[model samples]
Target: MTSRPRTLIAVLVLVGITVSLQQTFVIPLLPHLPTLLHTTPANASWAVTATLIAGAVSIPIVGRLADLWGKRRILLACLAFLIAGSAMTALSASLGWFVAGRALQGIAAGVVSLGISLLRDHLAPHRLASATSVMSTSLGVGASLGIPLSAFLAQYADWRLLFWTAGGLAALAGVLVLLVVPGRSRPPGGRFDPLGALMFSSALVCLFLAVSKGGTWGWTGGVTLGLFAGAAALLVLFGAWELRTAQPLIDLRVSRRPQVLLTNAASLVFGFSMLISSLVFTQLLQMPTAAGYGFSESMFVAGLLQAPGGVCMIAMSPVSAMITVRFGPRAALMAGASVVVCGYGFAALLHTELWQLLVCSALVGSGIGLAYGAMPSLIMSAVPVNQTAAANSLNNLCRSLGTTTASAVTGLLLATMSTTVSGHVVPSRTAFTTVLLTAASAALLALVIAAFIPRRRPATTAGPLLATPTAVQRHEPRPTP
Candidate 1:
């Protein structure tokens, strides 16, 4: 790789890390938000939910806009949102303002997909896999680091300082990107699909709201059921409309390709498997020792224990790239899923010790690194160059949906299956075991789906690219198969 590409990759990775950190930085502060903002816990929860909903809605839109406008322009706009949101959160003294700021921050969630698209546009074909792998791994790295970083800041400093720090980092990323990243490509021209965007966004919000709040609102309650039903109906309509539109927001035709379809299916399951380890292990580590399975570690300690997993993810990026270069992204994905299954199985059997949990987390993180690294390679291989951002965004959206499903299902299980320990109701050992087994099952399913992904022609072979509506051909051969 040239020095300029290296610099561009570094800047994009830093931007990816910054946006990801914003996603989790407020988690440790959730419990205190009610008191700090002088609001009820139910209302305070929106601070988190706002970010999630906004992110889910923004991803595809930003991606489409990037394709319509330019990658760098959209990226700078995302960073602006991040910086402005961080500043707003830092300065806010009320719940409404805080939630609004969080929603703005969520707009930056598409940075990773945009970064991957940017790499595809600018980097050499040989360099694309490694660069995208590193970019993909940045999501895990930022998430893992955000927990401890936030916990420490919440404990030792004014919590608002965390947002200030986020703002500073985002500002730095913007400066670096402005200085080093090259100018934009001529974006394909098309009318903005307002109707399509509206339909998709509304459906996503309804679905996500149901998933995020189903437990708190009672899953059988009118509001929860109504949201789910509305989401389903809207999605069906959205699909119908998209199929007939001339310039659809998401080209269902392209999305239905066997490789694209199966990779997305696998991505959803992989997302579920990834979140299961985090949700289960965090609670297990912090539960009172009297609970039989608890490690009774402090939040910071638990966070630190999981930090090595992020390191493992970063370390696995190059390895994942090498595997993609040698065998194929499909092979790398299946291998990663298999590793995740083993990790979850290990946790199911041997989570009694802190070291065991740490090992399991690291193992799972390694699998996540490998799988995530391969997913974009798979998507980019199948999609046109111009549509790369939108396609990658859809893949990322699938993963988010998976995480949401995992959170809902696991929350329900932990809530219902509990044991009394010193007058406190805690999730029983069986609950943890069940969740782990479920996660393992999801990984096994992903492996199966990955196995069916059609092998691509080797990068050395010159062949016609997969056909799409836009008919944008790849400038280089597909990644090795």
Candidate 2:
């Protein structure tokens, strides 16, 4: 029933803006680089790929650092890094320099993780789940909002202006984080796990490279095979190292807890499934007006159509919180997952019309709004507070991994499958249906996993504490929201 301090909400919004800006700004500019910078499409593609690789590899490392030093401080540092990267990008004339700037921006991608952990640190108990959900959905919101703005600017304004605008936003985010968020508790003399970071980063980089380039490289070709093999080996070694270390980078034992593991698994599957709709819908929307079922809108209009989904997600946050409160995190999650399954089912059945697409999008958006909100609560319920940033980062990483996987598979399927409908080419209906089925199946799987989450016995509503805090929180009752 209590309200969270507005300062914390401000910080979350700033984090979302900064993190989303890094990814969204480059999208509208992707094809232009060939002429703008005299670079090949292949080389320019790295501008996008580098950021993703950096984000995936750096999240856990930066998250661990946030846990060690301070989440707020780390967040500020990331913003600073992002600002510098944007500035470099703005100034760059060569593709290589621009790529370097993007890579730097990628390293700071932990802002979202740090923001989620901070919510658990600062928000009121009754409000935590809802706040977490909004924060999770910010990723979607940022993407939706950024794409159109970036496209408009790239199409009309100077390309460098995009970086300048992003730089200004990053600087503002850094200021807000410093001015608003509270300081973190000093960890108990734990050293940064450099070895663990190296191993994990190496694995993620290799794995990501394989996925990002697999379509171009041929999945079984030398580059993809080598990267995949190397990634698997390093990840296995990283797991072994973590189990042996006195202060492991990630506590595998805690991760194995049902609440932690299943939420993460669900996050991965749902994240991937969600991307299918976005990708498919975008392609469908942009297909020439001559193509039936295609709107053939300009960049701006296409972005606008999808933008409302983010708004829908933000609107659903409060509802999701109420659901979590009334039915527990597991039930809330299962409900959300079920809704997403139904969303995909609707999409599969109703792909022939525009209104049908909009309805499916709304269903999927609302369902994701609920799922995103529930994940943080589930993780915080089972893990230690000091590990929150790291744990949350891991969950985000899973989602990212899922997204990357979905994109790769979708690309492959669309490339291989096609049909001529009324003499106009389009993605094979059969291929698209297969993807919808896959998405629905993933959501159903998440629902099944939600069933196994351990229940916390009922508790009185009067306490400042949660029913029972997680392991780290038991020591100090770390702020729970």
Candidate 3:
């Protein structure tokens, strides 16, 4: 591989990591937000919710914009939002300001999808699989590593320093991208679909708000039900509009291809499967030993235990790429999902020791690394070159939807299935077992879905050159097998 591709991949992966950091780093600070900002707990929770809603809204918009404009340009714009938002939060004293800042930070969520698209545009066919694998794995790597790092910082340093650190990292990433990443040549020409973007964002916000807050506000309460109703109505309208629009924000026709549709379906299930381990193990490790099946570990220790999974994810990236190269991405995805099912199966049976949890978490992470890596390759192959960013963004959005659903479902399970221990209610062993089984079932479903992805034709010759107007006009050199 050339040094330029290596440098480009490293920079993009770093940007991906920074974006993931923003997703989880604030989690450790949630409990302290109410006191620090002098607000009610209910209000403080918006710090998290705002980010989630903003991210969902921005992903497709940014992806479409990246395809229309330049990916590198859109990437830099996202980092600027990250830097500015982090700075606002760092300096804020009021809850409103913090939530606003968090919402701004959320806009950076499209970086991973954009990075994958960029790789498709630039890399040679032989190098694309591995480069995209490492890029995708960076998401899990950042999420797992950020938890312990943020916990340590929140414990020892001022909480605002976390945002300050995030800001610094975003700034650094922006500068590196500016220096190393090459700009795209044939930027797709299309008018921005404002109506579609508006409808989509509005519907998503309602859907996400209802899902994320249904437990807190009674699930059947008028507000929650109203939000759900509104989301459904808007989504129907949005779908109709997208179908009619000349230059749609998301190309519905392309997205409906069997490969794209099934890959996205698998992504959602895989996402749920991935999040269950994080939700289950963290609580399992922290419960008091008096609760029969508890480890009573500190938050830091629990996070540290999960760190090995991140390592396994990074280690598996190359293997995933190899699998994608040898067997098509369809086989690699099924293999990954099968591995996840095995991981969850192990967790369901073995809950006695710390080492067992570590092993289980690592197993799940390895599967996720492989599955996540394959998704982009599957989506990109099915869509036209210009639609790569938007398609990947939609896939990423599906995963987010899956994770949100997991949070709601698991929260309800743990809340209802608990035992009392010295005035505190803790999740019972049965509850934990049920969650593991549910996660395993989700992975099994993903495996079934992966089985249906269309098989690729045998390679008779080298793959096509990078898709660009210049390359189209004058035949570019294909990579030698």
List the candidates' TM-scores in order.
Answer: 0.94, 0.91, 0.94
Best model per TM-score: 1
Ten contiguous residues minimizing lDDT sum, candidate 2? 457-466
Sort all candidates by lDDT, best to worst.
Answer: 1, 3, 2
Decreasing TM-score order of the candidates: 1, 3, 2
Task: Write one digit per residue (lDDT tens) for candidate 3, span 94-197.
Answer: 99899999999999998999999888877777889998989988888888888878878888889999999999999999999989988756666677999999
In model 1, the runs with Cα more than 4 Å from the true position are 1-3, 457-481
Worst 10 residues of 3 by lDDT: 457-466
220-327 per-residue lDDT for model 1 (tens digits): 999999999999999999999988877779988778878899999999889888888767877888899988889898777766777887888898898899888888
Name the regions of candidate 2 deviating beyond 4 angstroms.
1-4, 184-188, 419-426, 457-481
Collision count for each candidate, in order: 0, 2, 0
lDDT of 2 by residue, 116-182 (tens): 8888778776667777877877877777677778878887789999999989988877777767777
> Which structure is stronger by TM-score: 1 or 2?
1
User: Which pairs in model 2 have colliding backbones?
Assistant: 128-481, 133-373
The pairs that clash in candidate 1 are none
What TM-score quantifies how close candidate 1 is to the native fold? 0.94
